[model samples]
Target: MGVGDVKRRIAEILREVTDEVWARVAWVAVDLTKELIRTGRRKIAVLADDVFQAIGLHKAVAYVKGLLGLIEYPPRSVDVVVAVVATSEGLTRREIGRHRWASHRPIWNMPRDGFIQLYGQIPGGKPPFEEVWRATGGNSKLLGELYKAGWSAEKALREIADERKITAFVKTLRDEERELLRRAVDDPDVLFTREDIPLMERLADLNLIVDALPERDPWFWAGEPPPERDPELGIGRHIAWQTPLHREAVRRALGG
Candidate 1:
């Protein structure tokens, strides 16, 4: 398919999914606004994944704002699109040097329990949980890529590493992100105190690390942080590799 066809298909998928969401959850959204408005609520959070990559931030936000303006209601809820990587006006962008939305919200990183739910749906059968976890680290993007191979999950992971994606990622790294990703292979937990927040914010915005807190306490992975460290630094949560697979890829990229 040409780029135009690909974009058209994506639009079609989004339109279909939006329709489905409205059909099923529109009432919930309406009720939520109504009740929340009664209580003086003003923010309606909408997550737009890859919005920056697919369409520039400005246009995407304008489109969403237009949608919000059309809502016939009294609560006056404003839609706020949180970013995976946004520009200064709080919109996700594909470019590397954008000021990330608000590093407050955690992006997509499903824990192990989520894998069980996903496993049951696969056709051939879920591979061993440990192997799957090791290979993908609950990263939906990598898992989706691996799932397409139709082989056992382990085999798929072993066979098709994204050399191109890794190459692109390598080229984008600056001095700091490169150093951070390099260290991540040896010690996955990035302790982000107030001092590291700026760097952490940038890294998180880039989808390099994610907030790993209360969810995976006492984590038992290859480079798990010490349990007591987070409390001592007061860094809320230890930032972790987006995926073990990515970390492994980085290790190879960094000549580890």
Candidate 2:
């Protein structure tokens, strides 16, 4: 859908969504998180992409904004926070720290056991959902489409060709793929070969590129930069502005 179409749909969803739908999404995400904990995973990192699909960002962000307010003065549970908050950015450590009125202290304690029981009890609204959906829901469809199209991360990354929006973190890579790529780059003696399919696959998953050698391809290792460049190499060299004596008029313009 075009930007206008998306905006209209989101406005509609916010105006008409029921509490049942809200509860269902929360339940699914919480259940998945609980399972991760059960499997001995200490930290359950959920990508907000799925929730953004279900609910638009304007509504989602509003929900989170409401939750944050409730969390401060009234002290809401983290599970409730997850239920209302759809995007990952809202749940940052800084955000959590800013919610000062919460009766319950924030918990980041480690060594959490396999059975970490956390309860969530908070009602929706007390804030409008439409506002939250608008901010976070825009890219939901595109991301979902790429995943459905059998596009690898590397493929998506290459096709998109913009790292600023996508490469927010390195954990986007799968464990095996990360290991393979790390090994390929770190060991100079090890030539990248067909055997490195898994590594290539991983990079593909993250939307990065790794062109074939092709007798000397410029893109052989395109996305990655050489690791050993000196930090101070560019020290004390050129002037910030490229003008000799500020070029007559330029100096007058700056009131120098």
Which tens-of-lDDT digit does each residue in 119-216 have in candidate 2? 01113222132221221121233334334445333443343434323333234656664454344332312224567654443433332322222222
Lowest lDDT sum, 10 consecutive residues, model 2, at 234-243
Q: On residues 163-228, what C-alpha lDDT tens digit does candidate 1 reach at each position?
A: 335556666767777787666556656535665566555555545555444343334432333233
Against the true structure, candidate 1 reaches a TM-score of 0.50
lDDT of each prediction vs. the true structure? Answer: 0.48, 0.32
Top candidate (lDDT): 1
Model 1 CA deviation exceeding 4 Å by range: 1-49, 60-64, 67-104, 150-165, 168-180, 188-206, 211-236
lDDT of predicted model 2: 0.32
Q: What lDDT does candidate 2 reach at residue 111?
A: 14
For candidate 2, report its TM-score: 0.22
